[model samples]
Target: MPVYLSRTANFLLTEEQLKGLLKRYDINGDGRLSKKELQVAFRGLGLNFSGFRARRALQHADADNDGFITDEEMKELITYAAKWGFTVN
Candidate 1:
């Protein structure tokens, strides 16, 4: 499940990382995370989350809108997170 995100070769996440993020944010267990779902999930995990912020992050990653973010999407998301100073782990 690890995905390679190439952007100056600085941002990449392994499959375990992806699974951790999914398990952290996939509150609904629907295999995907909506804006609200992400918020709830993160918050439940003791993360200080904003729905709008998480939405933007999810939108950046969920390219196919297939509801769930694929491994590729997760890679892109890591890149974005690294670029924007969001938590990448």
Candidate 2:
């Protein structure tokens, strides 16, 4: 299970914690997040429209337009996700 998905529902996730949790979804072990991986991450965060959220995240954070969120882009992605104030239990 994704780390965030396993967290307690009342637990408020910090940006740093969200960052680490998101990183664990890099299924290809490429150290980067693809849109699909991001979708799953958003779903793990208990989002209803994960697909839309993932696309928005890419748009907001994929600086190179390469269709993947690399390490450098991760900060921006985290910042974006942080705005939602995700709470996982």
Candidate 3:
């Protein structure tokens, strides 16, 4: 579900695809997303400031304050990602 975008093209990802894409970055196979994992995921999406973005993502989506993005919190994360767009450019 990793999408490549041109500078002039805008691609919007479906929630399911976005979710799957993010889940694929769970390096520890923990069924959750840690800050580091999220940094990698954001980098994969061709985003800058991935570390900062990851921290913000956790802040916005880590509902339980557990420092991880559980399945239950994925919707907010997906929304956040979508809002920012997955465009490579």
Best of the candidates, lDDT: 3
| Residue 61 shift from truth in candidate 1, angstroms | 1.6
Q: What TM-score, computed on C-alpha atoms, does each candidate reach?
A: 0.52, 0.78, 0.81
Weakest lDDT window of 10 consecutive positions for candidate 3 = 1-10
Off by over 4 Å in 3: 1-12, 86-89
- What is the C-alpha local distance difference test score of each model? 0.58, 0.78, 0.80
Q: How does candidate 2 fare on TM-score?
A: 0.78
- The residue-level lDDT of candidate 2 at 53 comes to 89
lDDT assessment of candidate 3: 0.80
**Model 3: lDDT of residue 18:** 71
TM-score of 3: 0.81
Compared with the true structure, what per-residue lDDT tens digits does model 3 show for residues 12-67? 55566678888999999999999999999888877888999999999999999999
